[model samples]
Target chain A: MKLRALAHSRTGDKGNTSNISVIAFDPANYERLRREVTAERVKTYFAGIVKGDVVRYELPKVSALNFVMTETLGGGVTRSLALDMHGKSLSSALLDLDIPEGEE
Target chain B: MKTIRIGSGAGYSGDRIEPAVELAEKGEIDYLVFECLAERTIALAQQAKMKNPNAGFDPLLEPRMRAVLATCKAKGIKIVTNMGAANPLAGARKTAEIAKSLGLTGLKIAAVGGDDVIEAIRETPWPLVESGGSTTDLGNRIVSANAYVGTASLVEALASGADVVITGRAADPALFMAPLIHEFGWAMDDWDKLGKGTVVGHMLECAGQVTGGYFADPGVKDVENLARLGFPIGEVSEDGTLIVTKVPGSGGKVTAQTAKEQLLYELHDPKNYFQPDVVADFSEVEIEEIGPDRVRVTGGTGHPKTATLKVSVGYVDSYIGEGQISYAGPGAVARGKLALEIVKERLALMQVKTTELRFDLIGVDALHGPRLSAASEPYEVRARVTGRTDTLAEAVRIGNEVETLYTNGPAGGGGAFKSAREIVAVQSVLLPRDKVAGTVQIVEA
Candidate 1:
């Protein structure tokens, strides 16, 4: 199963840092997200794209995990040569993460 | 049980006006907030103001005000916005003139300013958070440096009997929180209430974002009538409880999922979401689907705020030169690749001093690149070449190199477009809160 099946995400950027929020569609999947979507796993998941450290913050009540990726926008919106200047599509990239079957 | 209904009118500067008009006319909101400024918008507006003293606010300011002013005034709904961009005083005066022109009299408009810290920055050049270098490193290229202020001045303006509040570079959440503070008389240091109010403000600040406009994914996260997506209206109580919903009969859904997604949008750390008024903590916040299109959000906690305020510093980063041309028919992919290679070699031959460059195939790997996009032959591909250079002349050559591909190489290439412009980059810095004092000026029509 892909993370997209169990979660929906939104990405926001400032300077060169991108903050991506992955919220579970079902509250039952929150624990799975907590276990699988570690900051290290997320950093490895976006290996080539994100250059800086990845920090994950847990919001148990909201069943969401916020992953903040630094130095990811190439050079931020104003300077980035990428088409998606704000890294808005990064959420889609993150949603493509694979989760084992029966995990959901 | 006293609740204040605040509606988000516009998210960004060029956001849709009709939705805002809908929010004003039908949403029955006490305050309509328009978060019209982005990080770099004010800097660009400063440049525009330098060129024309009268033209620094949002381009749609006049039209948006005209469209919503009468109805809002008639309904006794107050307006709060950072549409003032680089010049709040001018924006307020312009808005006042518009009200007078509309034959609406006795409209009180307040412009809160003193966010601009360029002079102070010049006196004591602080190091930017992005680059540890001092502001002096950017030299005269620096355009604008405005610190994000809080709800103090805005609350004062609202309390001064002003119907509309115009501001420059105030924190986005503050635009929504000011009315809450003023209405509920929330003590400025009341961290818990401020945190809860900030949560509501953050959710509604992006307008349609939380109401299914940005949440829609066909088949997966299905959202209804996204095109006519209704903006969000937050019903906040004196004790900081909030119910997020949209106007009845309007399009879009405001589910707990949407509210939860928005709760973390642009948020770095849920434990410490920094705002001038409070260090908001959303980690303990709860969202429940109390009803259809209504989510009850509560339990947002907070700590004392930091002494320094974040300042958005804008400077001339560099010049960007870009060119795009479409290649169609049998070997479009091959031709697009060849076009890109030719532009690359041509830029080298022309001695274009590029700091960084990107060559992309729009129909293929422009977005995710080869990582996500599987290599496939498309019938048509748009070849785009972009580069950043220190000088405008060098930047122009980058696009000129690509434009040369029109006659130099590639087959069936057409619809060529080229552009070169200076890149005004923005970064954040922290300045002592006491250094940048804010003031409110009221204009009556």
Candidate 2:
């Protein structure tokens, strides 16, 4: 199953860094997100697009995970020549992450 | 609990004016805030000021004031904004003129200045946060340097009985937080309250975003009436409790889902979201839907602020040249690829010197690149070629190469568009809190 089935995400950019938040639709699914969505996996998930390290911060109270990816945005909004300069669509791309079916 | 209602009018400079007018006329709010400055907006405004001294503020400031001033005044709703981009004094004067022209008297407009620290930056070089270089490296290329001043001067402006407060380069949350401090008499050193207030400000700073404006996902997360999406109003109490909602019968819904999405938007570390006022902690913040369109927020706290304030330094980075053309019908994907190849070859043939270049198919790989794009090809695709160059002449040739594809390369290509523009990039540095002073000047109508 895709992560989109259990969660939603939004992307925000500052300088060359991009912060993406993934929130669980059901609070019960938050633990599943925390267990499956590791920083190493996320960094690999965005292999070509994100050039630097990815750090994930868990918001347990809110049932969300904030991933701060550095050296993204193609050099920041003001200087990036990319069509989606702010990397706004990157959140939608992360929703395509595959989550394992069934319980662990 | 003595609660105050504050409406978020405009999120950015180009945000919709009608929603703000709606807030002023019928939102039944006491204070209305418009967070209009982006990272690079002030830098562009500085450029505009160089051309015309009186024209550094938000261009829509006049129209926005003209639309909401009378209504806001009639309802006794105080207006606060960073629409004063690079020049708040000029912004205040213009607002005063508009108020006087509208026959509204006894209106006090205050402008907070002293955020401009370019002179100080010139005097003593600060280490750049992103580039790991000193301010001296940029030298003459630097266009503007404005420190992110906090809520002190804004609180002072409100306390002076000013109906409207304008500032340049203020922290976005400070615009919303200042009112809470002034209305509730929250001490400047109250870290916990300031943190909660920062949460409220962060939620309301983007206006309609906390509503259903940006959270719509077809079939998955459905949002209704987005066309008439109403901006948010924070019902805040003295002790820093907040309920995020919208005007009754207005567009968009306020639920825990929307609140949670906004809570983490643009946030890096949830444990320490830094602001000029306080280092807020949203780690334990709670969101619950108390009513149909109200989400109660609590559990926000903060620590004392850092010794230094972040300053945004804007400089001429480079020039960007871009061109796009659409290809449709049977072999659109192949033709689009051919178009990109031709432009790449043409740029090389023309000896175009570019630091960076990109060839993208709009529908297929424009956003996520080819790795993540779908395997199947689309019937229609727009080929885009973009490059960054030191000189404007070199930048212009990148687009010229793409435009030639209409006649020289692709078949059935249409809608060729090209543009060349200078890039004003922003970097940050930290200035000691004591080095920057904020002062407010009031203008009466």
DockQ each: 0.87, 0.93
Residue-wise C-alpha lDDT for candidate 1, range A1-104, written one tens digit per residue: 88899899999988899999999888898999999889999998888789999999888888889999999998788789998889999899889899888744
List, in the given order, the native-contact fraction of each candidate. Answer: 0.90, 0.94
- Residues forming the 10-long window of minimal summed lDDT in candidate 1 chain B: B367-376
TM-score of chain A of each: 0.96, 0.97
Q: What is the DockQ of candidate 2?
A: 0.93
| Clashes by residue pair, model 2 | none
If candidate 1 were superposed on the true structure by all CA atoms, what would the RMSD be? 1.2
lDDT of 1 by residue, B94-205 (tens): 9999999999998999999989999988887788898578898988999999999999999999999999999998989999999999999888888999898888889899
lDDT of each: 0.90, 0.94
lDDT of 2 by residue, B1-445 (tens): 8899999998899999988888888888999999999999999999999999999999999999999999999999999999999999999999999998898999999999989999898898889998688999988899999999999999999999999999999999999999999999999899999999999999999998899879999999999999899999999999999999998878998999999989999999998999998999999999999989999999999999999999999999999999999999899999999999999998988899999999999999999988999989798999999999998988888888888887898798999999999999999999998889999899998
Error of 1 at B195 (Å): 0.7
